[model samples]
Target: MSGQAVLGVEKARFLYGANRVFDSVSLQLDAARTALVGENGAGKSTLLKCLLGELELDEGQIIKSRGLKIGYVPQDVPPGLGDKTVREVLESALPHTDGGEDWKVDVLLDEIGVSYETAQQTFGSLSGGWQRLMLIAAAAKLAQPDLLILDEPTNHLDLSNINTLEGWLADDDRLPMLIVSHDREFLERTTTRTIFLRSDGAHSFGVPFSRAREQLLHRDAADAVRRQLEGKEIERLEKVAARYRVWGVKNDAFHKRAKATEKRIDRIETERTESYVARERRLELHDGEIDAKVALRVQGHTVTIPDGSRKLFTIDRLNVAAGDRIAILGVNGAGKSMLLNALARAYDPDQEHYDGQAAVRFNPQARLVYFDQKMAELPLRTSLLDYLVAVDGATTKDANALLAKAGFPYHRIKGPIADLS
Candidate 1:
């Protein structure tokens, strides 16, 4: 296969109202796998939309061969019709005819660990993780698109399912792919290149995420040193100028030398000062010994839906001790949320069973603030101060400080949180 399956972007520009999301951003995307990464609001999604022709560029051009088949797996699945089943969704992608190749769908479902009986069940009843898995299988199996774009494909998958997806991506002959994922390991394992979008625009590097991270860190360090040197030079110029002003009043010879030194200092200081690059805030939780006083423990926990007589999930054993900051690992329907609820006794216990010693003062996952992938659930209607009051108690000064740290402006604090998005 030729690398030119996907061509380069020549000075592309994308604008939303007055805000220019991409300004003369250029990149070359070949047939090799690539990863797109950026912080929230960096326009990563917008760029993908523009590439797919869903959004037209305000300036420049994206040239590609006609009839370029592209498959896009969105971060969130749209609500499906209740009448559709898991198998139906997959089969729908195939051309309807008697004696057609239905085996492709079957093979994919099996490979992705979806059972035949489960396939027959209604899609609406399936867990979110399972739906994500089915969608991935469908995209991979049905279209075999020349280019596959997956956004957060591993969001709901458990470790096992994630590994399965990783293996699929790793297959040497797999089609060219652009994955938008937060899973550092997944990007490292699958992509040969990375496209990072910043507030200013987008840039591409021919390296994996881990290597790219190292390069970025090294560049930042170099930039910091340059800035420090520039600052020192500026200080030196200020001191020389002060000495010149003081000495010029008394002695002619000394004044002339001081003036010459000041001129030289000014010329040196004329060089541009490098801008300081802001670093991403990384949250690091302290790791402490797990206390014997268990907050939650489950053994042989399983969830079975009444429809299709299929076993939805089966967990052998799970445990959570005090001060354990454990992340639940599973795909959408893998029953992670359900297990959490069951462990917390939020819902009926009959849905799942557990046998183990458990004690907990609080549900860390539930209580310790949540930043959902979709920011829609956040308290958008309330004022920043009001929202903080609800979460951390009513302290206006403390709320203002925390909101500022989170990037909320003083002027915007009083505005509805909905306006922030």
Candidate 2:
């Protein structure tokens, strides 16, 4: 709330060829941790890239205080760091100094309550939540950046890990941060300022996420009402101008009044307030229906690590009927993903791979689709249109129609999926 401006962008505009991601966008960051929120594909990630100089704006420029340092944590762990030890990964953030700064890593880890034994393991061996937390710790503690930028920091984190992150971010040191996250509760807990990135521009507020969102909605409503009033005034002026023109046929003096009224109408139209109403997009799900009461059955299943190193948990019996919605809950290493993977692998539409003694079974008519939370299955380089067309039974026309329905512009269909926000 009371801090110097560390970084900013003024009247920024970025375009992917003909597709504009955001226009006239501008915001400044200070000492308070700020939440940068918007709907998916609204260029939140793109804006961070622009701020970090990873991407160039088509128009406008980035502003940073001289000698400013920035620490950035992406949504995903960067590639090739999986095999490195956690200590090595944290050490990478440090500048070369006399002797070394490796001791700082242990101190930071101890402060965060991560065990020393875990530090020696490969970075990828840790749980997804811990990996993200370690990266953030390295950035905040080791890098000593003037401003820290985090993109989706709560992603893949369990409730406990999320609380840990909230505490770390809300520390009394008051490090400057620009956090892009969809987690409203997390933002409200950790951030003091909020910036809403919309297509028209960025709106900054000196309040937490919920309060900032309320202010934004109120502003939009006020603009809408003002526009309506302006429209009515323009209509009234037009009618008066038309009447004046008719009267001018009888008196020359009325022609000047008609011209004056027409000019006022034009002025009102020119200065009219423009409000943004985001386009509607639907994430359509498959409407496939199984013609059976029981869609899946599981019995005597021992869930374990993928390599069968050790058992995680055991399930005696479970049945999922058609229209039944179930949630699997667990902490970080509780085999929730492993159980899901086992069930997804066990689904056999042909019903030829299983005997009556199978641990998992699905109805003959049951169809299955597994969505990996990391989205590793998707080919990032593939165009959206091509990816959609590659689907079973999907024609090119059908793919285009689906993309349109999902609110993707035609120009974006040819762009790689990685380019999507």
Candidate 3:
């Protein structure tokens, strides 16, 4: 810890129209590394925008140290940012464009372990995890940022890359960072400071995330104890008030005492601490028996690029049983997505057929629902309820119920689909 604040927000309040997203929020980014975490739509990203000076505080102010350069890696790569080589992407990220052997660029790439060969590959061609690493490398090196802000940096990262990032954070790079990620292990490994954003306010825990969570458990326990005590006190006061009113109905002394006790009860009722609610979500698999034993089959299937000259893979047999679970693992350019896409296209209701695959068959009883890793098919601009409703003409009320069952809070049902994280 430097014991000096790199960034500060004092008495800050942010609003969207009439809704106050953050109220009287005051915090300091002092440590070399910090984490900003909250449930979906708790204004974590908004606060990050406040820190980066992208969004102005509607009430208070943001204080930044002089000569501070902030680097930001958003949740997703910018739209239309495909087909460019990694080197070109890094070059574009730099303050000044130059040659491959640029001293500063090389130094930053070395810091992230992005070699010249990997740098030559198309940025868009890299796997999701590699792309995440590349983006981090670009943000860390290109801006030469004193403060780096990453939004869900571990979203697509594999185990190896997540470990790599953890190691990168553990090193004494001396770069102050405020990363917004829900990866608990990653946060425990990387950030020393955890700022938990709640709906009412933000709680800053000056410890690792796991320790912070333990402290939160303690606090919640303490709050429960205090609440129980308060409840008993209120009950006692109410009993006293009732006895006094009944014993001396016409006396001013008894009336005064009862009224005072009632006032005290009101205060206690209004000032109660918010109870902690534990959240648990799980997917319940159905026990229905499929009509067919073989849920899917692909015989002599080979996926190739559009050029038809490059062979991705040749599968002699791919038979998925009704209850079978399969995992596809491959390095970059290894056709994991291609294989899935081919299978999904094979089962498309539109009856679309690809030129490469010899045979693609699905059981008549089996229905395929492919969830893309990017979720690109989802409507980003729509609200969650609206998106679900529009998907199948379901009522908004029904959609809201579905989302609630899926663990979305009632307050968050109206939030934009793209901003779920």
After aligning candidate 3 to the native by TM-score, how far in Å is the CA of 42 from where it should be? 2.0
Q: Which candidate wins on lDDT?
A: 2
117-236, model 1: which lDDT tens digit per residue?
A: 888888877766677777777776676677888988887777777788777777744588888888999899889998876654565778999888787667668877887887788788
* Model 2, span 142-214: residue lDDT tens: 8877788999998877788788777777674468888999999999988889999888899999999999999
Candidate 2 clashing pairs, residues 3+ apart or interchain: none
Worst 10 residues of 3 by lDDT: 349-358
Stretches of candidate 3 off by over 4 Å are: 1-5, 17-20, 95-101, 104-121, 278-289, 305-309, 350-358, 390-397, 411-416
Pitting candidate 1 against candidate 2, the one with the higher TM-score is: 2
Where's the lowest-lDDT run of ten residues in candidate 2? Answer: 1-10
Query: Each model's number of backbone clashes?
Result: 13, 0, 0
Q: Residue by residue across 1-421, what tens digits does model 3's lDDT show? A: 2334488798889987666677878888864588888876678888888888889989998888887777889887876567888777777777665564467667766866778887787777676777878778777756567778899998777666777777766665578889899888888888889988876577799898999988988998998888899989999999999998886677889888888889999999999777766554444566336877888878888988545677998998888989887888665456777788888877854445533344888775676767877887788888888877887589877777778777776766797877566
**Model 1 reaches what TM-score against the true structure?**
0.72
Each model's lDDT comes to: 0.70, 0.86, 0.78
lDDT of 3 at 270: 100
